[model samples]
Target: MKYYLLALWMWSGIHLANAQQAAVKVLTRAQENRILVRWGVDQPLEWQRANNSGFILKRITIKRNDQLLASPEKKQLVRLPIKPEPVESWMNLVQQDHYAAIIAQAIYGESFEVEDTGEQSEVSRIVNMVDEMHQRHSFGLFAADMSFQGSIKAGWGYIDTEVVKGEEYIYQVAVANDASIASGAGIAGLNDFEPLPEVVDFMALPDDRKVMFSWGIIPYKGIYSSYMIERATDGRNFTAISKTPIVDINDKTGNASTAMYFADTLSNNDQKYQYRIYGISAFGERGAISKPISTQGVASVSTPPRIHDYEFKTDGSVLLFWEYPKDAEAEIQSFEVAVAAKDQGDYKIVGKQLTVSKREFSYSKLEASNYFKVYAVGENNQKIASQSVLVQPIDSVPPAIPQGFKGQIDSLGVVQLSWKANAESDLLGYRIIRGQDKDEDFIELYDKAYPQTHFTDTLSLKLSNKKVYYRIAAEDFRHNISDFSEVLIIDKPDVIPPSAPVFSNYELANSAVQLEWINSTSDDLNLTVIKRRKKEDVNWETIASFTDLTTVFWDRKVEKNQVYEYLVMARDEANLWSNPNNSQITIAVFDWSAVEVIKDLQALVDREKRVISLFWRSVAKGETIAKIEIYKNKKGEAPTLWKVIHAGQNALNDVDLDINTEYQYYFVPTLHSNTPAKAISLTVQY
Candidate 1:
């Protein structure tokens, strides 16, 4: 029986046992002379047992004159355990109170089961028996709660007429056979009873042939478990509209609802009605009634307007016609036409309010894209709108051609183009066309029309074309194309470097280096540059630049016997340099200082021996000499080293020679100094 009751409590979403741990739950209401106490068992089995075995009531004085009593005094309220009145004794009370009859039937009925037509399954039979028992237990408790007299008759209530003034007492109730007790405290004698607060924030909302009523529940949930609603056509006289008190069933479902609501249907529209509410406590006590709230029911506009036809005029205006039910027309107070620029955009009323007799309206203002709808506004201020219809003006003419089209290409091949925007109101955007040549067919640069006045494009620098062309055309909302604007020609950036100059010949004489080169063949060549650097130097210095077609340059700033590397490059108007590898040359300047060192050098030719003897003076003061070298060469030929002499020697003989040949002998001395040196030469005929 305990398990069955627990299952039933869980299924019904009742939190009686979980919220109150005691087997019996008690409540108390204080009065001037008497205190009313109510008690009930949380478990159905316990309640059934208590009903058979009766319950014991006890009281304790805890405080006097607001002062605590250190040792509480206890007393038994009844000498004998209190039990339910006999079934025969309830006959008179049952005739007076319906809830008393319900309690009587629940306790004294022969069988609590519903009459069954036919049943054979054991499971079905058991389930029906359980359901019947749960129904009896729940209905009996509910009935006892709704009637104070019923609770007393059921032995769940007590009236203490012996309460003392200015004293607080704690009451306890327990099943006669159980040790567990439920307790509650109340003050007696002192007027502790105050009027209950009226239903809070009570409101009524009138709708089409219906009214919804709601009131704050959280503020009064502890004071009232249910409510009774009353209504009246005239504000003076009111009567209960509900057959029974309305309980908030959502409390069992664990709904945290702040307000309780009740909806009532009206017999007719536009009729005034007044409503008020009364709160019913768990102890079957009705609280103070709420203030009356009044409103009138309004008729509903349910029929939507339907746009059957529309026409576009030559003046760029539109006319719309709609249909509505004749029977529903009486419910409508006015009509309206609405329009939006886009299909899903917010719509606004287009013209002044239209009467119910009007079925057509002319819309003078129009946009490129328009969605129109008709609405029927009822007397209740509710509006029902029709399906939106797309409307477009009749237009065959395109927008004017775009003008002032121009652009420039950067060195990175990025092109920026812009044009004057078309002034036409219906102009959607512009289309750009591009081509490598004026004669070839142009291709669209973008998949869709551009809505801006300016555009940018990147070109491949690897292409051979020097110039690209672009053209723009205006387009309207109806996809009409205008004539193409003037073709815009833009030059591609010059990224290719100029051809490098070639070194034709070079000479080393008079302690100076002279260089010659062939100029670059590119037509856009801007300058010819000459650069020179010592063979050991990491950086090159520019020595000369010529804007003209000059090919020869003499570098007189050179030192004797120094090896210098020269580069001749060409630069174009775009400031691009030529390749340095193809235009570089290395030369050694003549050592004129060596000629000063060996001013007295001489060479004698002996025709019989076929040899040339060379002599020179060495080492001046502050100069160190490493060795002397003899170089012999036939006239008009480059010299070759003949012999290396010791540092102490200043002369050498070249024996390998041809007779009658005008030979030149060079006397070069290797010096261990930072000063420049050159080889001195003398001509000898052998």
Candidate 2:
């Protein structure tokens, strides 16, 4: 019969042309007397062209007596081109071999095209014609694979009886008088022969009334194109179950499987049957048969056991009870009980070989927590288990108290606590309680128990408490509570900073600034820092720091006429600083020695000229005056420097003075010593 020729197209060790080219494929097998050769075209168009033109066979003897022949001998097997026999000749072979009939029909059929139903579009007609040509090519090649004699008659295969022992020959086949068409070649010799290996990994799975068989396919893909299965009841005499060779068609698609499978229905259950398999090569040769495997079908279990109840005795033992149908007792060989410490843990068989009549089992070795299941074994050793049931022994003793207690509180008032977990298998969880003091009542942190060994608690840092306490207790599944663990004491972090000191008063004496302030009211005050900076300065420089309760500071290092800003900040033991907004003050140092330098200043207003004449007396002692400056201001306005006067002149005329307005005039001197000089003023009206 015709096969699909699926995986057989990908023949191993065959040198094929490029995928873009019309490639021809060839395969060879060596026997004791002769070598067999087969050739085919991969493309449908090439296959049709080859059939119409027939083929020419050529042989070249490349080696003789295991030695290379320098001058090879070439010969043409037939003077005329080889073509398929006439349709009349195929009639005799078609009556005996269905594969021969398939080939004859594919080549010389009445209608070589698919009949168009109703869709007459050009694209549909083209697609149908291409599909029909591919179908013809595939069936013709697949039928040739079934019969060696038919393949030779179809001009696709040949046998070389002229091959000599220890002589290698290369054979080539191509369409007659057409060198452009693709050609195929193969190398074989009488000595190039080895026995094929048996089929590998043959397996059988028996079911109620059917048996599934499978074997490894990928490993033997190059050696065998198909397989044949046989079965027997007596294990000695075997009968072929497959009328034709079985080809793996599933491998034609993507993601091919590595194994091939077949299923056989049995006449009755519980009857032993032996099975074996054979590998068939592309050249119609069968390899060694597989070793026989025996199996018997078995009836499937209708229902599994059900666990109803369980009881815990006072002696620390557990008794489990289950139920099964009484009428199906004969189908059960025995029963087994499995147990595990946890629901999802690995379970082990606890009771083995239990009689079918027994519905209850007593387990003497019981754990604190256990999950149990019962399984019923069938006559064929098939086991069906029941749904698992949890059984915790009657636990009166609670778990051990949590150990290794430790805790810490951060500056943000977040507390973290951790301890060693309890070792009891039945422990449910832990409970944590917190208190601000040892004598105060503790409060539960969570409504339900915490499931982990670590816990976190957020406390209010605004409270007046300085210490916090934590304790943990472990509980079991039976609600048995353990004693509280050791108390964990953690001092609360100092988030409250000390209050700033206020500057009450300050005095300048002898060019020294004396500052007095009230100290911070916080009890944890560590130090007071005094920082000073000029009015135009960007950063402050710490002038002094005091750890004691000193509210007075003498800033003796002072400069005249330079404005200075001071900031007093109080710091606590936690290195937190107080706000400086209420404690900052600015002061300007006055030069007392320069105040008397410009004395006896006078101003005269001339109404007729609309001008004011000013004059000052210069002592010219202890310092030389580089220049003098005159200042003028109205009665309620700020003063402005009116004019600058030369050192020797020491007089200035202010013009355009406001009439009927009282004005003030001041005189200042710029000394060569760079000392600041105070201004002396006189009031005048025009």
lDDT per residue (tens digit) for residues 401-472 in model 1: 898898988879999998888898778899999999999999999887799999999999877566799999
Number of the top-ranking candidate, with lDDT as the measure: 2
Highest TM-score against the true fold, candidate: 2
Residue 293 of model 1, lDDT score: 91
- Looking at model 2, residue 536 earns an lDDT score of 94
Quantify all predictions' global Cα lDDT against the true fold: 0.78, 0.80
Tell me the lDDT of model 1 at 168. 84
Lowest-lDDT window of 10 residues in candidate 2? 3-12
Q: State the displacement of the C-alpha of residue 246, model 1, in Å, after optimal TM-score superposition.
A: 1.3
Per-residue lDDT, model 1, residue 203, is: 92
